[model samples]
Target: MPPIRYRVQANGPLRGTAVIQGAKNAALPMIGAALLASSGQTVLRNVPTITDVANAVELARAVGAHVEHHPADRLLIIDASTVTSPLLPGDLTRRFRGSVLFLSSLLYRCGEVIYEGAGGCNLGTRGLDWHYRGLVRLGARIEEKAGTIHITLGATAAADLYLDTPSHTGTENLMIAAATTPGRTVIENAALEPEVVDVARFLTAMGAHIDGAGTGRITVEGVDQLHATDYTVMPDRIDAGVLCMAAGITGGTVQLVGGDVLDAFGVARHKLEQMGVTLRPEGAVTTASRLGDLHPINIITDTHPGFATDLQPPLMALATQASGTSYIRERIHDARYALASELTKLGASIVIEGERATVIGATELRGDTVTAHDLRTGVSLILAGLVAHGETVIENGRMIERGHADLVARLRALGAHISREELPDTTRP
Candidate 1:
């Protein structure tokens, strides 16, 4: 597939509904964990059609899972019972950092495995120090080669694991490895994101003992064998919020169907309210209302219960439409401000002060050529393109398709001007 660019033009304010997709973050790791089950096969429904999902599926197949994907049904099935150790391709693993999660599952099943350096969105140095640190504490002998990190599981039980940064994937790597070990393992300062809880629930369904998944601490009691069972993935709350921003910014009302509104999106609603976006209670189909005048507000990205760092880039795009200056402080990924540069092309004035950003609203934006730095940044740029005057061409559109399925078609359905065009890689020249 060649590189893609989005040609976007806005309608007289966006006026329609946009439904959310499955949680990309949750489904990727959950599908990866399917490798730990030896008795039955795991089926994942409502998985997103994104690059990360593709990466996870490829990793599963490489690790010896009988993988099958049904795009129409949005389902993925994996039978890892006959799993084999195929020396997970280093080139493949470097595509997405989530591949690091496989280290634990593979170590538990095969006792010895070789892995390459983790890769994902280039958001600065996302070192695997915490992951390796946690694994070493779990009695795993580790060595680093040219680019692969080989892991060997020692004959041992569980131990207490403390995360220095509450890394979600790191906690998951250790949790999955500890599930098959004998004895108790406690993970302190564990990530409390809903996706983290989903990972814990999947492990519990596979016979692993776990408690306090959606909290700061998680305790796991190792089980002998994990049997597979059917499980449903949680809704994509971040997707819901991003789409909601699309609706609100366009002066349109949209209903996010089939989602846990209060649990997953209550904080987003509260944040939007500060910017003058209102949510009307309607049970399962919640409606979003926005005033023509959007005021700037202060936002701090943190772990779950606070504004999610994943939605920060898209939300920053929304902030561009606000009336006053908005402050956005990103605690997770500092380099996330790359979108600010693109937004600036659309007449947005954003000042970067360390990890925080101050954004001044632009009354009317004139579209121009912009580059997408990563997945979320790509989609956020697309959103900006929808509201910009004239044509907005988004470079690096493949990143958007990685997380969002039929994104251009979906926006078109909502009456936005959008189309995907292939662009050549000029760097070769």
Candidate 2:
């Protein structure tokens, strides 16, 4: 099979409506949480058909769960009643970072799990110290040998857990681990992202008792058992932000359908408005358009209710079209500036000094060949391509498919000329 790449040409203002996909961040964790149920089938609606979710489904099957995925319908039905395997295949687990989320489920089901760690995009060092510490406090035994980890759980007990930073995956793993442990477990400095709240609701629907999900503190009361239930994943705020920026960059208007973007994009909505993009909410649909001159804005990425690190890349691309200089401080990931050089390939003037990036804009951008270093970076380049003067070719475009579902089709629906094509097998020898 040939590698895939994205070819985009400068199109006029993107117009029409775009229905946001289900949250990839929310869907992956909930898929892991579904394994907590020993009987009955867990039906998940509004599941995005992304590569990460496909990897999660394969990981679930590797551990003995029977999964039925209907991508056309955006649904997943998982039956983990027969799960008895403690070994998570290194081949499958190493595909994406979400593989680590299976730890709590496998440990709870088989009393032991042998893992080869986790893998994802190269976004600096992401250690699992918090996850290990919280699990140890919950009475789990962990040992490392020759690059593999062995975890064993015995008589699960509740304990107080604290995170040095409000890690999203760390919070979900601990919450799921404590769900059936038979006592109340409290987590301090917990992640308040909406995805965390969605997972809590899913667990609650499965008979787990939880409180304070969308706050800094979360409490989970362990139950004797959890049963399967039907749940719907939340809309992807990151995807919505990208589409909104698509409108901003192209100087077009677009309507986002499916959910309330106002609630999902907390502080980001205001930031977009500051950049001269008007976002109007009409119940479940929100309209994004830019009719005035693009203005430069300062951004500092942080936890929820603050600017999102995931949306920073797309915003950086948008900043190149704004007048004056736009400042971006990436506080979450150290190597987020990987998109700087790629954006420069398309005539973007970006200066990176440590974690801070300064983008000088209103420079007539001309399209050029660029690389998609990661998921967000890939989407950022696409946004640049939509407004560039000529044709733009984005290499390694499959990375974008990991997060966004029906990306090309959706963008085309919004009146953008973007297409996915096969790259020749140049390495064939």
Candidate 3:
């Protein structure tokens, strides 16, 4: 297959309005949650038209569910009434991490599941110990055979679950597994991400009794069954943050429609303000603009209600144009500094030691070819390309497409000179 690449040109003062897509983080898990319904069709509205969601649909079909997707309406209808497969395809599961979410529903519906493990971006060690421990406590037996994992559940009953860290997927997995269990389940140190809250709301709409979703502690009362229903996914906060940074990096003005940026960005909004990005929120619209020089700011990535690790890479790209040095400490992913080397390719001065990275600003960035190691890093390179001295070509554009929907089109609408192209495969000898 041909590789996908992004061709970006230096376009200044991007001025326009762009609509944010539905949250990818929320939509993936909800697809798995929808499979918990034994009958009827589960309809998801506002779903992002991304590769990850398409992969989820394929995985759902592999497990015997009938799925229909409407990209024009951003709607997905899933009917798991005929789901009887216990095996998850290794090809699909190895492509994305959201595949792990289907474990709970498959175990609940088929009593057992054979999975080939989960895979996503190479962001250091993202172990599944928390998810396994939570599932084991909830009466599921898990075993590793060869390179695959075999999980079985017999008469599932609720139990107390605790996570060493408030993992987003861990909390969602446990909540989904406990939704149809016999008793009440308490999850301690639950993830407080808005995506998790959206998943909780989707599960709630399906008749799952959940409380304290956006808190550190969440309690779920298991019901005998879950009914399919229609639910709307929330707007993508990470997408909003990236677009806002795009405006900041190009010294432009843009209005983001579909979500409240002030509340969605949490502390990151204040950090953007600290860096001289003006953000004004009115209802579902937030206007982001920068009329002056960009400033430097310190940031520490955390779980929820804090600086998001996903947004750190774009912020690093933005810091390159700042007047001074900006310090970013990545506490979430150890290998997130992988972006520093790629940024340096564009003439940005960055020093990385351990999980701490120091970005020196006011460096003249000249466009060059770079690689997108992950989704966030891919978008960060695009941000750099927006303000670069010349044309910038970003390889491995699929990474950016995994999370952001209509990214190039949306950026073009906002006056960014970016286009996606597919390079023909040249590996033939």
Q: Give lDDT tens digits, candidate 1, residues 123-215.
A: 876778878877787788888878778888776678898988877787777778778888999999998788888889888877889888888
lDDT by residue (207-262, candidate 3, tens digit) is: 99999999999999999999999999999999999999999999999999997857
Q: Estimate each model's TM-score.
A: 0.96, 0.98, 0.98
**RMSD, one per candidate, in order:** 1.8, 1.1, 1.1
**lDDT over C-alpha atoms for residue 169 of model 3:** 96
Q: Candidate 2, overall lDDT?
A: 0.93
- lDDT values, one for every candidate: 0.81, 0.93, 0.93
Off by over 4 Å in 3: 426-429
Q: After superposition, which runs of candidate 2 have C-alpha atoms over 4 Å from their true positions?
A: 424-429
Candidate 1 colliding pairs: 50-402, 51-402, 96-119, 97-119
